[model samples]
Target: MTGEDILYPPRASAFSWRIFKTGEIHTVSVGRRKFSADFQLVFRLIKGLIFLTFISILVTMIALPHMTIQDIVVCILAFMPTGWGMLQIAQALKPLVRRAGFWGSVKTLARGYEIVMGLLLFTPVAFLAWFPFVSEFQTRMLFNQAFSRGLQISRILGGQRKGRSSRNKE
Candidate 1:
C-alpha cells in the first residue's frame, strides 16, 4: 500500500442500497413446505430506477427548458428531483432506524436533513420551488446562469474537491 492509502482508508459507507437489496431473504415453512421470496431485489431495482428518473428530470429541468420547450414541462420536471430526493432520504433512514434504534436514527436523519436543506438553500433549486415556469427567454437565460453559479458555489461550500482525500479531518 502507498503512504496516502495507509493514511487514508475509504470512508465507511453511511448507507447502502445494495444491502437493502439482496441483503435479507424472507421464507416461510409450513409442514415440510418451504416458500421463499426475493423482495430486496425488487425493492432495490425500484429505488435505483427512482434515482435514475430523478437525475433525468433534474437534467431536463435545467437544460431542456431553454430549448423552446413548454413551460408546463419545465415546471413539472422541476419538482421530480426533490420528490425523488425525499424518497431516497427515507430509504436511507431505514437502515439507520433499524441499526441505531429510535433516538440514534432520529439524530442520523436530522443530520441528513441538514445536508439536504443546505443544498436546497444554496442552489437555484430553491427558487424553482416557488416559481418553476420559464416565462421569458431572458428570464430563462438568467436562471441558467444563476443555476450554474449556484451549483459551483454549492460545491465549494458543501462538496469535496476531486483527487483529494475524503478522510481529511475537518
Candidate 2:
C-alpha cells in the first residue's frame, strides 16, 4: 500500500454503487487505482431527458399537419436558450470529452452543428439579452457544478448583457 492511498482511502458507498449500476458513473483507471467520476451524472441525465423531449416534439410536429410554420418558429425560438445552455455545458465538459475518445469528439461536433443551425434559423432571437439568464436558470436546476463552470466560461468569454437578474444569482 502506498502512502497516498493510505492518506486518501476509497470508500464504496451505496449511492455510488446505485449510480454506477445506472451507468452514470464512469470508472477511470490511473495506475493501479480506479476512480469513479460522478461529476457529470446529473447533467447527463438532464441532457438525455431534454434530448428525448426534443425528439418527441419533432415527432409531434411531423405527425401533425395542423402544426404551422409559425408554431415551428415559436418552438425554435423557445429552445434557443436551451441550445445556448447546452453549448455552455458542452464547453464546461470539454476536458471530459477529450478523455471520451472518438465518439465523444463526433458528438461534440454534431452539437456544434446543431447550435449553428439553430442560430441561423432564429437569428433575431439569438441576439436577445435574456438568453443567458434563462440558460443559467436551466443549468442551476439541472446541475450546480455545470452552472458554476458555465459561469466561469461565460466570464472568460465576456460580452454578457446587463439586465434584470434572476433570483438564483449569488
Candidate 3:
C-alpha cells in the first residue's frame, strides 16, 4: 500500500460496483469522507429552512395589530425581513461575489448597499422601542437609513432588487 493509502484508506470505488439488471446497490459511505453532493444537500436544506422562517416573519409583518406580544416581540420580529433576511442573502451571494470578475466589485457594493438598507428599514423601530435613551438626531439618522435599508434587506431576503434613493428623497 502507498503512504497515502496508509494515511487514508481508499474508499470503495463507485465504478467498481456491479450494475446488475436490478435497480441499485445500497452502499453506505463508510469512511470519514463525505461526497460533495452530500454537502450540497445540507446547504440546500439550510437554505430551505431559512426561506420558511422568512416567509413566516413576512406574514407576521403583514398581519399586524392583533398579536399577543406587541411592544417587544412584534418590534423585534418585524425586522426579520430586513435585518436577518438581507444578511442571510448577502451570505448566500458569496459564490456569485467570487465569480463575475469585472462586475464583482459593483455587485458586491450593491449587496452591501442592500444590507445597509435592510438595517435602516427594520432596525430603528426595534432599537427605539428597546432602548429608551436614543437622541433625536440618532432617531432621524436611523429613519433616513431605514428608508433605503428596508429595500436592501428586503431584496436580500429574496425580494426584487431595490436601489437606494437620493438624499433628497429622505
Candidate 4:
C-alpha cells in the first residue's frame, strides 16, 4: 500500500459510465463507481439483439395500419418493463423520502405513480385519438423493447416521463 493510493481510488467497475446530456441522475452508473474494466459482454450483446428486435417492431407498427395479434401482445409485454422500472425506482426512493421526513412513502409512490403512468400513457392516448395509428404490432413492439430493456437509473432520478406528454396534432 502506498500513501498515494489513499487519495486516488482505483476504478472498480467493469463498465464505463455514459453521462446523460440532460444531466439526469446518471442511471448508467447508479451514481457509484463509474468506470470498470470488467463487463458482461454477453449480456450486453443479448440486450442489443433484443433491442434491435424491438425497434423493428416499432417501425413496422407505424408503417402498417393493421397489426397482427402477436404485435399487440408484444407491445403490452414491452410496456411491462416500463411499469416495472418505475415501480422499482419509486420503491427504492421510499426509504430516502421517509428518512428525509419529507412525506410518507405511500404518498411519494402515489405521486410518482400519477406522473409516471401519465407520461407512459401519452403515446397510446395520442395514437388512439390523433395522428396515423401505428399498427398494433409496432406499438406493442415499441413497448416490448422498452419494458424488456428496463428504464435507465438516470430516468428514475431525473423524474423523467414524470407525466404524460402532449403529442403534436397532425
Question: Cα lDDT of all candidates, in order?
Answer: 0.46, 0.50, 0.45, 0.47
Write the number of the candidate with greater TM-score, choosing between 2 and 3: 2
Q: Distance from true position, residue 60, model 2, in Å?
A: 6.6
Q: Each model's TM-score, in the order given?
A: 0.23, 0.27, 0.21, 0.21
For model 2, what is the error of residue 14's alpha carbon versus the real structure, in angstroms, after optimal superposition? 35
Q: Give the candidates in order of lDDT, highest first.
A: 2, 4, 1, 3
Error of 1 at 22 (Å): 26
- Predicted structure 2, TM vs. truth: 0.27
Candidate whose TM-score is highest: 2
What is the lDDT for 101 in model 4? Answer: 47
**What residue runs in model 3 are displaced by over 4 Å at the alpha carbon?**
1-38, 66-170
Error of 1 at 33 (Å): 26
Give the lDDT of residue 100 in candidate 3: 38
The lDDT of model 1 is: 0.46
lDDT for position 164 in model 4: 35
Per-residue lDDT value at 10 in model 4:
28
lDDT: the better of candidates 3 and 4: 4
Query: Tens digits of per-residue lDDT for model 2 on 1-170?
Result: 87644543333122222333223212212211222255456555555765675567556644553445665565555555554555467677877756764334335445655877888778865565367887766657888875667667676545344232333364
Error of 2 at 85 (Å): 1.2
In the range 1-170, model 3's lDDT, one tens digit per residue, is 66644543322111111121011111111111243466766655655665675567546534542334343344444433444444456567766645733233334445655786789777977777665566665767778876756656655654332234344366
lDDT of residue 97 for candidate 2: 55
